[model samples]
Target: MEYRKKNSITGVLRGATFSGLLLCMAALLAGCSKDPAAGPEGGVVTVSFAAPAIGQETAVQIASAASQAQNGQSPATRAALAENTTVRVVAFTAATGNPVQANYVAEQTYYMSGGKLVPCTVDDNGSFVAVAPDAKMELERGSYDFYAITPALPLGSDKATVSVAHKVDYAASATKGVTVDASKTYTLTQLDRKCVRVTFVIKKSANFTELTALSVTPSGAGLSMPNLPAAQSVKMGADIPAAAGSETLTVPASAFTNTDATTATAATVLLPRSAADILLTCDLTYTTATGSSRQTSFSSTAKNLALEKGKHYTFTLTIYPFDVSFTVKAEFETTISDWTDVPAPAYPYVSEGRYIVSRDALGSSDQPLHPDWTAATMPAHNEVSAYNALSSEFEVAAEDCNSADASGVTPNPGNYQYTWANALPACAAYTQAGTSAGQWRLPTIKELETIYAKKDGLTGVGSFTSYYYWSATELSGASYGAWAVDFAHGNTDGNGKSSHNYVRCVRDI
Candidate 1:
């Protein structure tokens, strides 16, 4: 009996020791199990397992159901384990980074029926309301993603992640046919796409300063620009999606020709009358299945396109000049009539054209104005409406001038009342005075000052000659010689009255 008792004690001790060893092994396993990483930068993912409780006597029926069947297996327990053991993923993203045409955008980012990530086109600013709580989707037992492509996304919260929860029971066997049946019953509904509207018509003349001038700022459909002067050759570009698909470029009023024509050989500015020489350019854009954008620039070559003002075009004018500046007149002196004549002023024996009508007719400063003026039929500005107006008054005599009214010395003349109101309206009126025999008058001192451009040397624009072209009227003092423009080095010589000089005609609007 003593020997038997000692054997029993030894057996009990062995059992206890085995139990301690098992506990140690379990602790080590729990501490050392490998786990997966989860975050925006996704990598391998993992979860831990919970072992079954020991020495717990559950009720007969409940225990049988909860506990493993033969060889650690049960239907209910097996299902629960299977549900916890594996997970499926859902994916999301923005199809397009374009905002609705409003100050702000309110969007609802959600999964659609049949597992689609569909987005509604937004046109106004505000939150999306009246959306259902649940949505239908079709997804296999794997991974998925969701997101918005609209403008608000950048200002919105970071990407949201939903990890799948799963379990598996070692004590309960699982069947091969086990499934989660995630049947099109997921929801990302009412995901607000809040936004503000920014609706505006294209500025009549786009101020380079006002435009955002960014790469993705869309100007028109199928077009994008940096709101700046475009360069000739572009480097490899980065892509940005927009709301529009196409774009049009418009020049104010009318720049290029509207009919078929050809460009001149070496002319920088081509105003084609019957030939094609004008050009317009535009940018290109690409759309994604989810509505993204990528810009590719292109140039346009056409004979004529009727371009109206205020219309918006995708391509901006980056490198171009539109028109020629106004021509300026110069001054000179002569020795014909003494400037002291007051009672009755008389014209010289002959007259010349300010600029030898044909540039080839010109010569040195001391040379004769024109070889033919001495013998040709040269008329006085007094015969032309423009000069007559300056000589006579605010209004000239229709017989020799353009109008019957007379100024003699007020309003447009030496009068104290010279207003931009009168001049500006008259200038604008000239636009409609085509072929009215003659239109536009010689500018008085103040008016002419605008075009009296002078520089260090007569390098370009004006004729590089030192000669006089007579003004219609006499100087402020009758004894003073009538004013004349000198073209050589921009100046005015008003000392020679009877001196023979050039004449140019003008009219009133």
Candidate 2:
């Protein structure tokens, strides 16, 4: 009996029943004389994939499960593709043991169908079907080599090369030189999980306040595809690193959850297997009991951290209190376990400036004048007045101590110092949090002195210099002299208006 080629075999043989019929037809034509160069148009090829197996590190798996149960917790949720997945398959002539360009035969994609994978194609409306009427796979009854990849990437004209996206759940398997008898179903090797799960745990200490930033720099492997397909290199993540450079994942402080008073769960992420040791750096920014900000950082290398496939690595960082002089030491511990689902911690802060406050007992003087301070810029050294002319001086109020610098220029103007004329307008023009012009002004002499007293409490807002700061108070009986405060020793002194001193603006709440 002669088998005739049809418009499409995938469209007609969409179900198991139809596929079985095709298999029987191919088996019956097994003895028919057909050229190897031309495919067996009548023969059918059926393919199926096996689910990935759990890793074999029994001790770690058992302990992990036991610990979760003992702690009344569930396994962490993860991003895995086991139940429903798509795979791309390519076929080539079983010429040599290895796949070659000249040996390429045909390629087709498969999707899930009733618990089994079936050859599929996109229809005109973009819905997937068994196959498009215009395109389908037809193979002769012969031995062929097959290569497969899951969570398939788009196939190009050249079968071997394809672009992979950043951080994909990737897997690949190959079956070599297998006889394709239409009556027999071919099961390629199992598609195992090819990536590792990385989780972070922060061990809190009595002196621990907050972890501002953390970054992990990978030397190799975790940020790229495992060398596969022979001679082809594929890179992933935002930027591929050079020989000495590295890629990293920087998690902000807010992304951690304080599960308990002593321990907290941080970010959990997936990375491809690494061929080299992984190195990471953690930076902590915290406040001292005296309301002063302090920063400390430490780095460690996970020696021989190949990051085997389907494994989980837990890194615990413990911070130590500083010495009386504010010196600190930190330690790190790493644990390996079977890969399991893990939930990422939630980020803190509902809105800007909305954060938890400490209930520690303290005097009113221990608090900062402005807990949320916004630092302003001073005028340029060679800058001219932004508002007033060179021959102008702002009129001082009669109350010398109360005589503050007004916002606008005065009618009775005297030799205006470029720095002094620019100072008041710079503060008035400064805007933040809906602050309008005239809201901020040069601090009065007394106000400047008070800031110096409580300056140490201004933690994490920014820093200050020990130099002199301009004050709005005019010097008594001096035409061009204004009162200024030297933060170096909290001394009040008179400085000529022409001199340029640091200008810090303050506003009433």
Candidate 3:
């Protein structure tokens, strides 16, 4: 025959139809040395599509449903479709056998999100169909991948997919941007249910191309808490530790202006805990894609936030007090007459006079006075003065009662032979200058405390008692009377000088 090619064979066709025509052309062109469309189509032969062999697995098949239909094949030649027609091609060094879902993009739009795009879905059922199969369609043309899921198909192993490789794509949009914005605060309905909700207003709409995600950041995204004045300072009705409070804060939409308000709400989320002490201060901040920040202080007694005095607390911050300091000094004070509601002196006043007592109470039980009860210091051997009482005989030193012949000190020969007469001269000299002067007069009961030796509770200021001594401190309204510190149970007691006690005046260096 001369020529007669079907018009359908020469025109534009689908992958299957075009593929069939190309096959015929290739066969016919093999014999002739002519251009494909240039020669006659007389030798065109009638042929049928190969049978879709019934195999355990659809790995072997001549054509898919549509292709079989177009080729006018019998159901026997058209294999009933299997749930998953894995139309993947072998790849070099790629996973050879894994039921791995295919990565894909739309053939029409070539838009795929992570090689897997979910069609609009319904709650109870799958509604989408596969648009492309594995690496079957123009594999080398774009990024090829095995189809992952068909929403219209059953889930689990029951799913059938049209794997596809898509051209690298993006969410090319009208605009692209990153922003930090606060939400226009609405009535923050703190649902008693454990949540704080503030309606935010969108300041603007941002657009981006190929962008798959958006991130929002909140700078000063915190609840406007009331100044947490110290619970003690606040004089709260409840225990300071149990005081409770809250505040109504005013927020504006401009806080998150220039972006989607919803995003602003999500980008910058503020949280306030009832259990936590909160500080409320006015705040404002801004940001780009990088970050956001804010500053505030707490209202409390110790001059700062309820933050712990010696505790470790942390937060996203620029800087914090690792150790801060200041200094102070303390002191001791007193006033002798500061007693409230009490008289200064508890004893009655007395006048100088002579009194009699046992010889021992004067100086020694058997000693004699150089002169008499009112006797004055008399010059004599060793310049010794006569003693009046035995009370201090064992307590007072011989030198304290007498002046020396040549040396500054003069003492007795024996404890019992010591005569008050020997002490008179020194007593007179001291009296002339100033009776019992310069620690040379008489010993205080306290000083007498040292009369004994540290040896056997008999020494040092910690021991010694019984002897009556003189005190420079005059009795209130009385010249000759004085107070004395006694080692007897370590107390303060008194007696008149002539009633006869020891003399040991104190001298300050």
Winning model by lDDT: 2
lDDT of 3 by residue, 325-380 (tens): 11111111011111111121111111121111112100111222222211132121
Residue lDDT tens for model 2, 266-299: 6444444335555555555445556565555655
Residue 301 accuracy (lDDT) in model 1 = 31
TM-score of 3: 0.16
TM-score of each: 0.22, 0.38, 0.16
lDDT of 1: 0.26
Misplaced by over 4 Å in model 1 are: 1-452, 455-462, 471-482, 486-499, 503-509
Runs in model 3 lying further than 4 Å from the true structure: 1-465, 489-491
Computed on alpha carbons, the lDDT of every model, listed in order, comes to 0.26, 0.46, 0.26
User: Per-residue alpha-carbon lDDT of model 1 for 368-470, expressed as tens digits?
Assistant: 1111111012223322122221111122111111111222312333322222223222322222222332243433332122123422221222232244444
C-alpha positional error of residue 132 in candidate 1 after TM-score superposition, expressed in Å: 17
> Candidate 3, after superposition: displacement of residue 83 in Å?
73
With candidate 3 superimposed using the best TM-score fit, by how many Å does residue 383's alpha carbon deviate from the native? Answer: 32
